[model samples]
Structure formats: structure tokens, C-alpha cells
Target: MTRSRATLALATTAASAAFLAPALPASAAVTKGLQDQEMTVNQPGLTPAFLTAAQEANVGLVRFNTRWDGQASAPDPAQVAAIKAFATKAAAAGIGSIEVSPNISGDASFNPRGKGRGPKATDKISQDAYRAYIRALATALKDVPVARFYSAINEPNWFRHIPQRGGAILYRRLHNIAYEEIKAVDPAAKVLFGELLPYARPTSKSYPHGQSADPGAFVREALGLTKSWKGRGRTASYAVKADGVSLHTYDFQADPSRKSSKRGRDAWVHANLDWAKADLRKAARTKRLPSAAAKRIYLTEFAYKTSGSDKLSTSKASSYLKKAWTVAKKQKVRSFLWYQLRDPTSTDELWQSGLQTRDGGVRSTWTTFKGLR
Candidate 1:
């Protein structure tokens, strides 16, 4: 969870054989590709470079999560301007869409250990706040043709819960309310679900029985009849289903150090994706979930750290990133997104996943991915 430092450099999004690589035997399909980045509310200035890089990489989408604290009372005008600016820049760059969330885990105040606002309290207030946030966001982007989808929150499953309720319940509840509010204004906008944190650790304190709720487990719980997600039925409304599923993967955390032989990493990717797809398919089969108009997986975030205290060499990071693109093509994932367009805070540990270092320098992964398209 701690991000290390890295040298910053500008990256060019030039396509490579790697980006257009053929499918691997065990991987899914990839259609659209994206890169994730952190942008603060009211910082619309950063959108141009991000869209430019995304266009260079041939990726059409960018993912960013909104912090509830920043927009709880009324949506921050600066943040609103930033999103609109992103859309304008993306359209000029010919990038496809933007995904935004309200109930994301960025604000420390909302996080359990940070300010102790706790997930439950945050969830309760944020859920209501999200309706307004999404409404306003959608309204702002309404004229922006480049934008495709909007989300209410980032990863709700990681939020803490009260004694009786857990993160899954809170997540589902928020999604339900948010979806209703979103569609009430804009029915055409697509909503994305399932932005689960990639790795599931056995030591995590966020799940039932303390067994650790990985992405799969979170999905299982959401679809489980006994769970009563969102303090109501396990089923999500049709409006919620209108949005496609969203996901991010980073095997580095699961198997850092490139220590896991290639075979092992491939196996891990195969298993994780297979399990997720199977579960979604099962839900659809049981008629418990709506069928996706589009059925490919979207890897909203994926990267290997290349510098700082825990730096992987540039060569190794590039190799890892290439392998991920290869696997995505093989897996037939609808689209894959690299972690970031720009590195915001050098102090923001997670920002190390960026294609560029904090100072705006390129990592090897950045070059490799540029050629991927």
C-alpha cells in the first residue's frame, strides 16, 4: 500500500508489436484499452497530457475515482471543470471515454485508519452524496461526445463496515442508490461495476470469517442470496446493470520480484480471470444478473513498479508490462488500461504504478505499452 519514489520522464504512446500481440492460450480478450490516473477536484489542467498520452498509446479510456469529502456538500467547481476539460481534451485526442466515481477510497478522512470517519459513516453519507455527484458529473459531460461511462465509486469492497454489515453490503447499497440517481437523469450513460482491488490477501480484515475477500469473493457475496447487499435484495436494479463491469489487475503485488517464474505468473492471471468470468457468466446464466451487451473484461489498472525504494529495473518493468498486454490480447479482454497518465504526488505511494514517474518521466513500461497499440 506504500508507494516508493521513481525518476520522472515524459512518455510517448507509440504502438508496438507488443500492444497488438496475439492472444495467449490461457488469457481472455481485450477490446478497448485505458490508463488510470489520479486527478484532484478542480485540477482540469492535467487532462491534456493524459489524453495525449492515451491517444498515443491507442487507448481510448481513462479511469479516475472521486473523493466524497471533496464533493459532499456541493460538487467542487474545480473538479467539475477538470472533468469537463478532460472530456474536451480527450475528444480532441480521439480518446474514447472517461470513468468517474464518487465513493472512492482516496480521502483519508473517509478511510478507517486515517481520520476515523470509518467506512460505515462514509458509506452512509457518501451514498446519498453520490447521487448528486454523478448527476452533476453526467450533466457536465453531457455535451462531451468522447466520454462513454460514469461510475459512482471506485472500490467499495475495501471500505470498513459496522458490526452487522460488511463492505460488500455497503458497496451494493451504494451502487443501488447511485445507479437509480444516475439513470434518473441520463439513461444513455453506461455505468461500470466491479472495480475490485486486484489481490486478495489472507490477512485482510475486510471479509467474512477473515478468510480475505478477493475480487472473486466480493463478487460472490454481491450475488449471494443470503448477503442482502445494500441492506436490501441481492439483486441490482436494471439501471445498475446498464453499466458494464469494471476491473483492474496487478499481479505484481500478488507475485512481486518477477520471482514467480513466467509459468507461475501466467497461471495466476489465468486462474484469476477465469474465475471472475465464470462467476459473472454463472450469474447471468441464473438470470440473477443482466446480460452484458459487451462481454469482454476491461482492465482499468495494471502496472509493475519500476523505480523508487522497491523499484523493478526498467527492463524488467517493460517486460512485465508487455507480458500483461500479451495476456490481455490473449484473454480477449475487451480493453486493458495501464495504471496512470501522470504521477501526481511523489508522496502518493500508489502513484508508482504510473507509466511515467512522479516527475513526469517515462518508465520502461511506458515505452513498451506505447508500442502495444
Candidate 2:
């Protein structure tokens, strides 16, 4: 899940002295010959300091969000320019790939009036608009080799992000449009299904925010394992166009070793993947979607919050990071991205999941991450 800009205020507190420990040497243990595996940070910009730090740590991917708002049927020109600039700088810094998420925000001026934030159940954006925006984005970045991976949306399963009554169906439509638009511009480009917020069960009906759907349930609906929603059953198959799935797997606990007491479910780091894979396999068999079972699983966002109820001491966070990587490798995850590179310094613990303090001082997990393959 991407942090709202309001949640990323600079830290006012001083970095803890313990974070002053020296970074591991470059010759430190490196995973030899791992293929198609990437360690990335989901920072918004490609700042020089961040790029330098990422290079030193041998991290080769940077994922960031770009907006498709402020225009009726195209991305904002300024946002397009910024993406191009980001790609150029990332390549210069030796980053291998850049993942772009074309997120739709709640800004009224950018979206059709009355159809953005807190959208009514009947609100819907035309497919033509979605296709045009996606096509423009893909065309703008087509020549940039690092801009090979694109996500259709970000956390659409979350009600606030795409809050129509039949959000799952709406998101599937958007994803299909985006996949075609992107592939039309560059067939080699890989368009990922939008990342989903991991929730063991579907959001409760009485929940205050829009009706957030469970990630598993949304995937099932998309892949045709479940019947179409109230007004969304027209499409014969929603799975045919999707290339792969992306997930944001942040468990409630900071310690990955703690097993989920839920019977028949895998523990800790395996929680989301175990259930997701099972759902996909069942859908694939029922719907005959050939690649559904083997589709690449990208754990696009995974990290322990360093503060709040989920807070972990620096040492514990480091240990969790290492263990999480071990589990992801064993599970054959395609890409694992730490949610952020720097923590927000505010007293709010939810925003403090970075590997470094807000002031850019290295946290213990920075050392552990550098040593990961």
C-alpha cells in the first residue's frame, strides 16, 4: 500500500545512536546466481542519495507511483515527464527495473466530477478514458528499458482507492483495459494485476470505510471461480487478460516466526501466499485459465511497521527481515519489495517501517538487507 503524502512528513527526532553502526562491506555474502529475483524499495523519487544507497546495497529495482489524474483521458504531462526522468536516473544508477503504478487518486479536479473519492455506487469511469490514460503512459515510457514492468492500479481491493459498490468488477474491467493498452504499445512489457491489500476475511459489512473486499475473494471473482457480483457478471472471463498478480503482505505482527493460529493456513510469511495460491489453483482448474496456477507471485510490498502495536525493536525487525526473505525465496516469489527506504519521523508508528531513520541513518535492518542475496 502506498502512503499518502500527508503521512510522510520528515522526522523531527534524532536518529538513535545504535543506528550508527557501520554498514556491511561490499564483499559481504551475496546470493550467487539467483535468477529473476529482485530486492527493491518503494520510495517515490529517484534522489541521488537514495540511488547511491540502493546501489551500495546491491538493490536493483525501484517501484514508484505515477498519477493518471488531472486530465480527462490522459496522464498529466508533468507526471509523465517525471516518470521519464525517474527511468533515466534509475538506469544511470545501475537499477535494473522500475515498476510504475498508475494510481487513481481522490482529487475531484482530476476525475469526473462526483466520481473520485467517496464515489457513489453508480459512479464509473468510461473504458475509453482508462484505455487512453494507460496507452499514453505506456507510449511515454516505451523506449526506457527499465520501465518494463507496470501495475494497472494500486490496492484496488481497498475501498478508499476504488470505492464503487462492485469494486472488484470495476477493477477487473480497468485491469483488462490497462493490460491491452500497455501490451498494444509494447508487447514485451509486463503489466501486473494491481496489488491487493491482504485481509484474511472480506471486510465486514458494517465497517465504516467503503466495503473493502478480501484479497482472496477479489482474486477468485476476477479468475471466475466465483459468480460475477450483483451487476458485474457480463464478462465471460476476467482471468484471460491478466499477466500476473501483485500483493501487499503486511501481517499484524512484526515477528515472522509467529504462526497464524488459524487452522489449515500457513504461518507468518506464508499466510497470504498459501491462501492465494490455493485460490488461484482452484480457479484455474474450474475456469481452465492455463497460467493461473503458475502465474508469478510478486510480493510487491512486505515490511514490519517499526512502531505502534505492530512495532518491533530494531533487532527484532532485522531478524524478521532476514527470515522473511528466506521464506520468500523458498516460496519462489518473483520480486520482494521492502515498503520503504526511510521511515517517517512522526510519532505515528504506522509510517515508520523504513530500513533507515527519517534522517537517513541506517537501521539494523539495513545491514541485514545488504547481506541478503
Candidate 3:
């Protein structure tokens, strides 16, 4: 994941404190959530301990990630059971599930560099295979009452990620595939759209290795929301569909109130999610997808880096968090999730944005995050 290098450019100096976006009153329906993939899945005593933690924190939802091939193959039955068990327990504990499929559409991998099969992300996913797997997974999980919202993939806007080149068009197709399948299994189920990274590069052009697509371009093309969208893809029938718009943000260097002056409408950032929502609504209107327009924006993943001089000061991180909630509230975001409850084990880890440090210390942002409406 050239993601480390991909985001290095967006690291801007923190914004002025006095220049905050006018904060709106928090929405009463907003459901705060947390995403600690490692802890929620592998934490010891997951039932009494982890489940209790989520219950205590008022977590309305928790995200669970899996690969398409893992469940489809059924080679290791426990892997599938673990997912069902987690959702069942979370439901019992009063937390709903947000399932994310990260990779591998079939029961095999293709190493683009070599013929031998491996986990090197060299080839794209096959939509047909992915659709079949998602349908099965959704049908299997239909028994788990809490397993409802499904996010197709994480960070489709990241550099060199799977389902690339096709950009939003590619991602939209994948999302629609999952959307139709999951909906078939549970009509009440929702397929989240655009688990896109929150950065945008310069306008369309041939790119060097490791550059990200202009997310705005991806979003528009994916939904056929462009200026003249009626004739795209040589068809009047819809190409891709989504129930809700999903975005992931970890724009560490800037404050949430810091809007992209030139790129706001074209891409997603903590500040520009409102623009994305408008796009989703416009697309839904043009496409006549009623269910898609009814969803509130879902900020599925977000965090601020703390502890290092290069990162935010604990106090600043906390301030930024309060501002993030302000942005969310103003945008009427349905869910605002911090990336992880605890930071990775060491500073070397790429995602240093966690509510609690690995050494069992909590940052000021912990209280600020834990208290978000």
C-alpha cells in the first residue's frame, strides 16, 4: 500500500484556531461508533470483556472486515463462524454490524509480478465472482439480525488499491454487485457506497506509479452523476447502485474545519463530506434510486495522529476532534467512527491515530471522542 507515500503530500500545517467552521447543534439521531478491527475480533475474552467495553462506550456499530475468497472457499469453517459469532454477540450486546469486504473476489490470488499465486495485490477483482460470494455471505448472515450495513471495500481511492483504473466506475460496479446481493438476502440490508480515502490528486492525467485518482472524478463517474450523465456507458439502465455514501478520513496534518479551497467539491475530506452527500443525492435523483437518497452521510472511519512532534499535540488532537464532530453535526452525518480504540503497537505502524495508546494511556481525544454525540 503506497498509502504511506500517497498521503504524505496532504499533510498540511494545522489551521488557525479562530478560523473554525461554524459548529451546528449535534443531530439527535447520530450514532457514534468505533472501529478497532484487531481488538473487536481477536481481543481476549471478546464476549464479556470486549463486548462489555463496546456496551459501556455506547458504540451503536462496529465494523468487521473480511476477504471475499475467505468466506466463499469455506476451507476454514471457523473463519466464517468467527464472523457470525462476532455479529451475533454484538447484536446481543446491542451493537449493529458494518461488514466490509476488502479483497480477493475468488478462492485464489494472482501475483501480477509472478505466475505463482500469492497475496501481492497485482490483479483486479472479478465483479461476477464477488457478487456470487457476497450473495452467499449475506444469505448466510441473514440469521444474524444485527449484520445489516455492508461496505464493499476499504479505500478504493487509495493509491494502487484493488479495483483501480476504473476508479469510481470500478468501485461503483463492485458496490452495486454487493448492494444487489445483500439486498436480495435481506431487503432491509444496506450496501454502503464509496469507502474512499479522503484525498484527491490533480485533475485527470496519466499518472506515475503511486498516484491516487481524483476522488471527485471517481465519485461522479461511479454514479454517472457527471454533467452529461444520461448517455454514459452506452446504456439507460443503471450501472451501479448504493444505499449510503461512506467515507474514511485520517487527514492528520490538517484540522477537520480546514476545507480544501480548490478541491472541496471534487473530493472528500473531513470538511468536504457534505459535497459528497450532495453528489449522492443528485445522482440518486437522476437515477431514480429512492433508497439511496434517504441515507445520512456515513463517516465510517476517521482518526487523528497523536504523540509525535510531526503529529498533533494531544490537546490539538482533542480540539480537532471536537471540530470533527462539529463538521459531522453540520453535515447531518448519521455515524461518526474513530478508526481504532487503541493505537498500533509501535510508532512505526502507519496508523497512529487511535483513541488510546498501545501502552494503555488515553489521549485527551479519548474523552473528546468517547463523548461525541
The 0-to-1 C-alpha lDDT of every candidate, in the order given, reads: 0.52, 0.58, 0.59
For model 3 the local lDDT of residue 238 reads 47
Could you give candidate 1's per-residue lDDT for residues 236-339 as a string of tens digits?
A: 33223535666666666333223334332212243356555655665565444566722546666566665455566667778666666666676567667666
- Whichever of 1 and 2 has more lDDT, that candidate is 2
Q: Tell how far residue 257 is off in model 2, in angstroms.
A: 4.7
Identify the runs in model 2 with alpha carbons over 4 angstroms from their true place.
2-46, 69-71, 107-124, 200-211, 227-235, 262-270, 288-293, 345-350
Clashing pairs in 3: 216-266
| TM accuracy, model 1 | 0.73
Using lDDT as the measure, the top candidate is 3
lDDT of candidate 3 over 4-31, digit per residue (tens): 4222112122111111111111354666
Quality of model 1 by C-alpha lDDT: 0.52
Once fitted onto the true fold, the runs of candidate 3 whose alpha carbons sit more than 4 angstroms away are: 1-28, 45-49, 68-77, 91-93, 103-123, 201-210, 225-238, 262-264, 288-291, 307-310, 346-348
For model 1, give the 10-residue run with minimal summed lDDT: 9-18
**Overall local distance difference test of candidate 3:** 0.59
